[model samples]
Target: MKINKKIACFILSTALIFTPFLVNIHSYAETTSIDNEEDKREQEERERQEEQRRQKERDYYVAVEMYSDFPKLKNDTQNTLTVQIKNTGGSHLEKSKIKVSALPGEISLTGGSSTTQNIGTIYVGNQTSVNYEVQVSKDAKTGTYPITFEFTGNYGTSVENYKAYSYSKTFYLNITKTEKEKDKSQYKPFLIQNIKHPAIINKGDVADLTFSIKNPNDKPMSSIKVSVSPDEGIVNQTQGVFVENNFPANGEKTFNVKLFAQDKAEKKNYSIKLTVEPTNPTEQTDSKSSEDSNETPKILPTSTQYTGIFYNAPDKDEVDGVKNPQIIISSYSYGGTYVEPNQQFPLTMSFVNTSSQKVLRNIKISLSAEEGTFIAVNSSNSFYIDSMSPNSSVTKTINFVTKPDATTKTVAMTIDYTYEDTKGTALTAKDSISIPVMQKTLLSIDDVAQPQDVMEGEPVNISLNFYNLGKTKISNLKMVASGDFTVQGENSYFVGNLEPGKNDSFSISAMPNDPNKISGVIDFTYEKLDGSIETAQKKFNFTLNPISPMPDNNNMDDIQPPKHDNKIIYIGVGIAVVIIIGIILKKRHNKRKKSQELDLDE
Candidate 1:
């Protein structure tokens, strides 16, 4: 009861959390109205985001949305069917081709069964439509019939990781009887590839043989079994395996089987019996069986093939049934981790023959790039090796220069080589290695505008200007200001992605406590193309004198009065007084003498 309650609670919580998102999506699709260009743009962006979120788990998917132009057709009338293809995958589909096939006679396509119309390219969340002139025979009934559509193409964001894929789906169409018109199909799928293998078996040896098994059906077939039985004196060491996935529709996969021969086995040719069958398969219809549900085993058609060609015993000296020799780039090195445009660097590579039982000779190696972005420096692109023993390796170094105008940031160099086996049979193989070519990141910082005499404990505005002057863009660009100061607002800013030849700037207000020079570093960091972190720093320094608070009138740090000499001041004052007294006495004496002379005269 507790478990059941917990499960119910969990379900309720999940529904509650997701209900709003569902409602928002529904409302946006059904109710939202685009009143202006901005609204339309926002709708497009939201749709793109929603689609990307929905396809997060799928790498690439191309689906078919088919419809017919003429729904109601009369006898001896012409009709057209329209095939629409949509790319809902994570990547772009290029060089796409769609082919339609149906049961012959009653209803026939204007183009023969071999016809395939080119749809070009379809971007993510985009659709491409093509019209096929479908014709129906006048004797056909008016019921619905199944028609299979096959799509094949390459998909990826870049050339290095592009992969080939094919999708086949069956859609029904209701077409009335009409006059017949047809053109023979010149389209042929690349199939029936019998990769030649040296299937020779010496006595007392185990041999592993490989074969390409293709699914000829329009739908995926599961539990495909390929059995190989050897003649007398030989043992089939191949064990049956449970396949986890179905054979891709209209595609092929390689399978391997091991065989062992007894020491006393006859040297004559032995007929090997081959059998193939599918346990359960997907069928095209209006309804489909649940792929994840248990399937009941049903009797299906099986093919039994016997090839009289048998394993041959090598001559008395040679060891047959040996695995093919493969040359691989075990380890490679260059002058630096990244190469710049028009820069010369030495590329050293070690080639190893990985086969244990085979020694390869006459190795002709040639290194070339698809775009010819790399050119050898004073050397040829091809090299020759006399021979290499089993499990042996040889290292060679070559100086090369990158093209000055190479557009790709990362270039793939292909190594095409051919070596001869012990029997002098020449085998050719191709290998590739990726090299990172980055344009020098030139982050130019406009002269940082310094603040006027800064005062401690006061906020000062500091701004920086920078530009990306390089040819490549940078990602996750972050700017940080750190020093002996307090930033008023955000000290760190994320610029996200910066495009080439783009300019940007940021500002921050910082308060310093130090009385001396206050210094701060504005560091800009971003991820390089090689996934390495690089940083460019701009240092800003200013003299910040402590701003004394308004004199507290009692604080000891305030200015004090100056001392004076009191003795000198006293002497000067006494002299001034004596001179005034002498002047007064002289005046009194002159007045007295004048009065006595006047009395004597009377």
Candidate 2:
């Protein structure tokens, strides 16, 4: 019995000790299994996050917002529009393009800018914007119109090359009917009916002139002042001043103008300009006289010149009542029937004598110019016409040139002739003619091609297109570039000529040295028909992107050159020279010792 109990106790003790050890082993195994499961979960989470990041990189998202000035667009009216684009993607985009499309039939776009625009580069979470001016047709219907905007571009995270992406969005616009209004200041209140003057007046004579003025507006104008003045050749008798107190509405008033003709006044048509103004226009009284001499007048100036005549009037024969000389211009023409400013052109004048009893003799035609503005190029100032029979006609040719800066203007000229009448009376008759000068040609620059990416320290080619936007031809056109950059190629390009509405292009290579806002001007010079030069300029601006620096990767083993020791080298050279002198002296001393020993032996 005792033995069985001992055995039981020993087995129980062993079981207790071993049972804890087995439990520990089981707990260890369980912990390893749990750790492995946690590692697997963590790995799956990392892979999922990588996949999500890759998906985001491949996606391109953009948020768009449109703004306009009017809530409803009106026909025949101009409106401003703004477009805002926000990048919501994970990559950077470059060279983005946007254009307005899918417009309704009632809509049209016109402005100084183009319809399509380049939005440049947009980084992730950044935005870009554009502005445009929109116009609608005058006869557009009132309704809802759809406007589509399309975006096309490439991204930086492409696999092989820049991947192209295209997106389109449509926005609606409400259209309404609206009429454009004109400015009230554009309406004129007065009208000039007729101006009558003597057809012939001699030098140092007073010219009696009559002019009629009518109020064309509904309201009556008071305190009216009239100013009639000559541009050249004559002066006003009363200092070119006239005043009227009240001008009746819808009624005409006639005033007489007296001007003093100068002694040096050539036979020319003078320009008389009339100016009118109203003072105290609202106040009116019936007691005001037709001459309204009580009120102060307002002064206004006319925009253009009025034509008048200056000449020596022909004497009338008392018995026959026949005028001695009568000269009239039958016809006139410029070369090729056209005249341009700065162009020397032939002006042919045909004169007719429409007199019955007068026989013309000793006829000499004299020409005078309006100084500094017009020049007589090829004709004599005093031309002879020989003689003209009664009721006969003759023709003469002269060449004249207008000023280079002359616009569409009338150049005044004088024609004076001396002749003897049939009754042996010497008479002088003067007449004037105006030549119309037109602007020949104008050069305009458009479609200038600047580099899309103007980077600092890089060469870029720039091109400019020139067009002859005028009615005539432009000659000797040249272009030169200036500002901010060094011209890599030829600085100037010579284009021979450009016809009306013709186009030509020139190119130049340039490089910017510094990172700054690069601005430049292209100077365009052209020649007119009369060999005069004119200049026009077009301006351009762009930002220069700086070049990226190379990364630094250095190592310690790169041996540097030995430091120069000029002082040590100089000292070593001096020591070597001294040792050579000492060796020569020692050799001479030993030779002398040998010579002394030989003498002792002798």
Candidate 3:
């Protein structure tokens, strides 16, 4: 039986330890199966959406075809071109067109030949055609040239659709070279295209001028140069008037010219002319021996001019109209130049708005004292003024108090204010005013009195007179005493506000339990006229007497009566009841026994 019990206990312990691990494995397996199934379903849905998108594009796209009638032609010979528009897709093309044009310099189109032709609505599986006459340039090289036909219009399956579509097709034609020589200026390799200038130039101000040049031909031009000159009273800065030495072609080039207007020049429109030319001409010789190759290449000089306006400085009247409002401190007044510690008083100050054009609105004045040394009484730190007209002034008053421990010195009252202009733009301004504060805390305790004889653990009352001998009022005055003496009840007392040369009295209860001599500091803390708080202390010393024991009294009156107890009374009552019952039973038994004896005797 013992062996069977041991085996059962071991099995139970093993099962309890591994049960949580087995449950965790089963839960992980279930979660993995759910995540894998969800991923497979999402991927299948994405593939279905992608296939649908590709099918929609195939149903909406439009296609067309175009070509030239002659595959080959001589230079300057006229040729005809044809275009075929087809609606090969499922939807109908509501409107479309084919516009033909030859590339400049390479080929040209006849004047009377139609270049752009419109093809009306063409339904699915329908087509349209257009014809154009074009000519290859006489100077065209022996190569193929492209003529572009642009197709642009709206198309849809229904008449209500407004979708726009644009496409183009270029047809190439083989051109045979012509024997005619091209004019040098007709297809100039270099040209001065344009000039850019600033819109306005104030007197005594500098202007930036830009000249743009480009090569109109496919071949490059070497030794390009640019020159410029300004009209009267306008001169260029201390830089070269002519820019030179560049091999420019096909691409555009820009050069900047810095010009300054004379201070005394008339405030009117002025102009500057710019010229561009190549410093060298085309040459086939390996070495130059002619004037066209050796001389500076002014290939085909081109000139143009640009104009701008100038203005003088504005006057004071105009300046005022653009300026903002200005705020400043005008004046201030206080009850006294100096203050007693922790005395509260009113301070009045004035402010002025110096703007000449606009009215100030939503004006607010905020006040702050030196940190830790002063505070605003009643939290009167901010005041509001609805509005102040231009060159107007306003005054405000606020209560301030100084801290009790603040030193006698001058301090600043910071005034920060914000206002809005007539246009509703907000602006902030700041100013400060200095004020002298007298911290002569002439407060002291006098007329100290206490019992000459005292004992340990005995209660004592000490009395003293307090006075404020400063030059200002001390607000919220309080007195406290502490040290070797144990204070009973309240250790501090309020003496209210004490004006200059004033006195007050109060009493404090204390007990001397340890020190042989009574000694402690009497602290006087109060608020000043500027709302600051501080403390001043006075030390005090007094002798303590030894403890004396009184004689004992032993009288009978002291041992009079025992106190009543409810539990004792209840116990006495129960005992008396038991005795009474016993007596009654005894009486009954005796009477019965006597009767029996009598019967026996009979």
Candidate 4:
């Protein structure tokens, strides 16, 4: 009964303690449930707020526009086009794409941005624009060019939200005939108009040039401007002139251009160009086209169609004993012909011209020879012809003379002159004549007055006679002597204009400083009237004797002669006597010595 009471009390105590603990545990569990529910509610509210914010922040909108000039174009004409895109969105549009397409014509996207940022979210009023350029076809018929812009973007759900926006604009492209396509017969023709002058123009001369503008096309022309460009030494009446009316179809316009040539102008032909300009309304039109009826005119050259005359002769050659020759050259007109050296010939040049221009006035011809040669005309003549038309000509005669000592060979003769045509344009012609030179007989130094012996410091006289048996004249004569002698007279003389078979006499005096060392040849050279040179030479010898003194005979008789003669005679005799005595003494001495030796032996 005691153990039962103890157990019951223990059980009651343990139950009492455990009952509070259980209650506290139940309360704690309730608190934990409330916290968990609060946490779940908070999580749900945050998620809802996040979803609402995302829906407000994320949005997509797109637009397109055309950017180009001449968008509303005409048919058969090219036009450039560009399309722009704008994204009216709140959030970045991912995988967003825009495509520009055209109907009926070729289209291309001139490079532009295709990026998420490029098509990104736009704050309410913010916009993004892209450009796509396209070229319209030239041959497209009259129609509307529909350009469509399509934009593709994304929305919230995993499934792609596609909001497609498209807009199109029509270009009223009309086909009309262009200016180039108008009446083909309205095309203008090509023309050439040119002017030419004489080869040699005198100063202060009024020269005329013919201007012909040829129409090469089949159409009639009008409203033309003809312009002239005159260089230095030339003056034109006007810079340009206009023809008010129309030109006949396939016809030429003829006019005369007067060039007031200045005296300062050199002696050569001058060239000028005539330009023609046609009138047109469109400034962009090609002036060279047939439609530009007022096109530049063409220049017709008459000189190219005409043939000029030429003359020539042979050149001269250097030779001995040759007389100067004569050559003649005649020309109907002017050209590049020139005379060569030592040439002998009569030449006539032919002239021709395709145009009907008449050459009037006398052609004044002049002749000139080389420096060493001479030219003489018969009566100082000048060539003259009444009148020469195109392709017609006449000849004039000329004469050239050569000197006696002139080099014999072909020589050149140049003939130059000027004439005026009916148009007042001065023309020139040149010709050459070759003349042959004949060989002339030359006179040598047949005799000379020279001394064979000469004393030092004595003057010696030398005389020479020169004769020319040739047909030409002689001039500019000179003579010189080389030695130990000083020339006291004139060393050079001018024998002007010696005729054929003429002789020139001259004297020279020389004083030699040292006659012993003197000996050499004398050279003579002279100029002949026919532009030639002659040379001759001669040799001389001289001797000089040395001086001596006379002897004296006054003191010859005052000197003695006997003593020296006798002394010489005695000396010779003594020498012979001494030789004989020596021989006799030698014999005696030998006998005595022999006697003495014999006595000693006994």
Candidate 5:
């Protein structure tokens, strides 16, 4: 029984896990089907609504046509119009209203007081017509008048259809003037074509003006007076035209007028009144007629006036210890005459415009020193200026110091200025300044002692003497050598602002690879108290001694004697001595025997 219970529990747990997966799949499919059905219904509803809206528009729309029995009529005759409204829809159209409007100065309704009227409701595919009578004014001009009729209809009171359906029609009503009216004379329209000179003229410029007038009148007319009066400045100073003149009908004429500008006149534009008065004063004496004639004054046209350019030249003065003089220096030298070594001199550049127009602003000035010789200093790098007005000028200052060893130097400077004229046109001007620097003789290298001959693997020494011939201070004094040689040592000293008429000595060492063949140039550079650099060069040569050779040690055995020969000589000498002794002894024995006998005998 326990085993059966365990198997049943296992089956129940497995089913529980897979049941959720199956339920989820079925629910997803059902939801998709519902969504598709809803979308189809929504689309059908939208299409039905669109069709209903279009049918409503068709039912509300009304067509209108304008017809006139005599569209073209004489000014003395009466004109009539018949307006028709029709509905060509499948639904009934109701409460239609038609409005008729006549343009101004063309036609007027004869007896009818109202312009708009209501026509009864129109059934499907029905038409309605109404007759309107209008009279053309006798004095109406010969032109076409546009008459418009608007029709409004209602289809079912849906608020939407009431806003959409409206129609309109338009036609022209030509009205011709009577023969007697056309025969009457008409005044031609005239326009002033051009003016030769400006309304306002400068004091020295000419002020000539010319005007063209056209006459389009039908009949001939005479006795016309053209006059002009000066509102300011000199009045009619240059009399170019009389007060009275005559112009034939349908004829044109050009009149010229001139005026002079006085020197004392303030700069301003002058106004002149020109009129075409009647030469025959008896024609219209009433105040009303005279006022009407003067309404269209024949004023001479004019253009704009302008003044010339004017300005003053830059002044020559000193600003902040800097010379603001207008001096042009094409050539300059440092460390000479007017300039001292290690001293900074200030330079100024000036410019101006001598015209009436204001000088342009934002003028840029660039300053640069020539390479190698001149040393530029101070805030004179580059600057911008605001503006220089008429008769105004500006100046800029730059500071420069002279190098200690500088003999004679030249400084070149350029100036660029830009401005706009009275007409707002751009104008540019360029100028250049040259400054000459005086030659300075101070702390200069008088002479140098460079080695003419040096041995290989040995150091070469260079000796130099600097003389302070000028009145200035020299600092950071040192001697340097550069070339194919290695510097072994240098004599450096801070002379600290050398006083005038003082001298200093310095030396440097150089070791060459092949001193015997050492022949090259060396450079010496130093600094002055004013942060200027000085350079000098010298040529040197070196000589070297050759190394000696060593002795050899092979063949010493042949110089000594052998020991065996000495031993053989010694043995031979001993044998000879022994043989001599034996002979003497034998003789002595015989002699002894004999001597003994002789002694016995003696």
Candidate 6:
């Protein structure tokens, strides 16, 4: 019984002692696990914040929001469009404004006479709205028309990021119709009915010129500015000024312009001037301009009006109260946009009689090209056309062979035409066509001339040989070296121009900065035939070994050189001399001693 009690007591004591240790181990493990999870969460949060900070580096950017009442429209229908411009950038927009425009006659505003509207100021992360009442033209075709909105403003000194903005978010409207309608899209609704001015102004005297303009359309016109110009020997007092007025529908408005005769003004009917702009515009459309570019070239014609003219400036001669028909080259096209060198291609063109009332008869057209660039193939440069009715269009195709050594350029071809009206009055006009020619680029370059093995901190001369393989010259040729090294001289070599079959060598001295990194790239950049820049790069790789250093004998030496002692050599020589002297002395002393012994014996 006693042994059993003792064994049970020992087991109980062992359990009690290990229980606290096990609990402590579990608690410690749980704490470490919590700390790990927390650390992971904190790292993730830091990464997210850093990403947000980098994204917020933008100084300014403004976006636009728009809505329209009608997505589609019929002829002569009116609608409303609301534009909301938002400043989503990190800065503010000062003196902001918007301009709305469309094809001059395709769409117009009903209640406005100016396309520009100011939106004073827009704070950061804010928005502003503007409204417009738009009307579709009666002569619109079955197509989708775009309404351009241009937003312009400044971002204070942050103009680098947001100088001026042209939000090209075009609002489109679809026009669906089956039958054709009358072409009244670009009709002139305003007329310069009368002009009142002094017939002549004396020297150094200013005169007033007035123009009476009448608006026949149903809409009112505003934003009209008129100016007058002067002729030879005459000074224009209104040179930099304009007379502005508004003319209601079926109403008349007069503009008065001032002109001053110069001191040497001519007396024989010096013609005065009067000029008008936006002739029949219901609203004055701002000039088309893009933010990135000064102005986008217009690809299509729009409604144009001459509200004013240079009064008595110059006039075309008329025969029997009939103006001669005007003929022009409407458009032209070729096999494609580009013509290969030394190849024959057909150029198709359309000749249009611009006069709606007069007919052109017995039209003779002649063509001429640049010297040695193009030649008419199997046909003369002149062609004849028979009688043509009023507002008629004719097409002619001419085959042309380019010169074998012709360069890449836009060659201009002159077209001179002579035609007669119904009254047999001869009229002549001249036009020019731009023909774009392209010559394929062919270039050869020498192999990479950089050293295969490079040494750190040492400058190596890298050379590249390039030759123009094409027959045409290449302009704006440049050579640039890029790598992880320091350049000793000019790293970029401007070749400027390379003639056909011309060869040139470019060299640069580069010093490798790191032992592990030694590589370079030579890039050849030049403008192609189409005026687009192109680059051809040749990459070279080399291994950099550290520069050779003087021998370091401090750490350890294998063979020790024999040590020399000048004192020992000197002492040995002295000892040898002394031995020779002593030998002689001893010999002499022995002879003397023998003599002394003999003398003693005697």
Per-candidate clashes come to 0, 1, 24, 60, 31, 5
Q: Supply candidate 1's per-residue lDDT for 507.
A: 65
Model-by-model lDDT, in order?
Answer: 0.65, 0.65, 0.64, 0.48, 0.53, 0.64
lDDT (tens digit, per residue) of candidate 5 on 1-602: 54345445644664575568546655765675566577668667866766666565554443434344434455667766677666776555677787875455667778864688888678876788877777878766544345787777676655554534566765545444443322122244333455455422334666666666554454333445556665555456555344423355567777876566655554333555555544554351212333557543232222122221111122244233322212112222333335554678766555553444444555555555444333568554667766656546666666767676654444555545555543445555554444555445355674556464443344555555667777545554444445666644332323334566886554455566564544555455656544578766665554545233222221111232322333344446545644765575556556656766777788
Q: Assess candidate 6 and give its lDDT.
A: 0.64
RMSD after Cα superposition, model 1: 37.6
Candidate 3 ranges beyond 4 A from true positions = 1-322, 443-602
- Over the stretch 458-548, how does candidate 1's per-residue lDDT look in tens digits? 5665777778887778777888889988765457666667788897666666667565666888888988656679988898787755565
Model 3 per-residue lDDT tens digits across residues 42-126:
6667567655544434346665544335445556777665667766666566667777655546666687756677787877788
lDDT per residue (tens digit) for residues 1-602 in model 4: 64456545655665676677557655765676666677668667866866654453344333334333234443344444444444444443445555543344533333453321235443333445554343445444322233554556554434454333333443222222112232333344345545444433334545566667765555445455566666665677643454534655677777676666654554333456566556533321232454555764432212112211111111134123321111123233222233323333343344332223334555456666555464453545356565565435455444434543565555565667666555555666665544445445355454655553443444555555667766545555556667667655344344444566877554445666675544556687777544568788877666645233233232132343332333344446556655755575556556756776898899
Clashes of 4: 60
**Under the 3 Å rule for N, CA and C atoms, how many clashes does model 3 have?**
24
C-alpha RMSD (angstroms) for model 3: 44.8
Query: What's model 3's TM-score?
Result: 0.24
TM-score of each: 0.35, 0.32, 0.24, 0.24, 0.22, 0.33
Model 5 is weakest, by summed lDDT over 10 consecutive residues, at 303-312
Best-performing candidate as measured by TM-score: 1
Model 6, position 402: C-alpha lDDT score: 89
Q: Residue 272 of model 1: what lDDT?
A: 66
| Candidate 6 ranges with C-alpha deviation above 4 Å | 1-326, 331-348, 354-366, 376-387, 397-401, 407-412, 416-444, 450-460, 468-478, 484-491, 494-503, 510-518, 526-532, 542-602
Which ranges in model 5 have alpha carbons more than 4 Å from their true place?
1-186, 198-200, 240-246, 280-358, 362-602
Question: Can you give the lDDT of residue 175 in candidate 2?
Answer: 57
Give per-residue CA lDDT, model 2, range 1-602, as digits (tens).
64456545655665676677557655765675666677668667866866654454355443333333234566688877677777766667788888886767777777666768999888878887777777888876544455787777777455455766566665556554453233333224466657878654665678787877776655455556667878666787764666666556577887777886676665555677876655434433322443666644322323233756645433445437876666666566777634676778777888877565677877878777555456678656567876788768898887877767665556677778777776767777776777667676677788556565544454555666667888667877777778787765356666667778887666555666455556788898888865679998888787656655444222112344454444455456556755765575566556766776898899
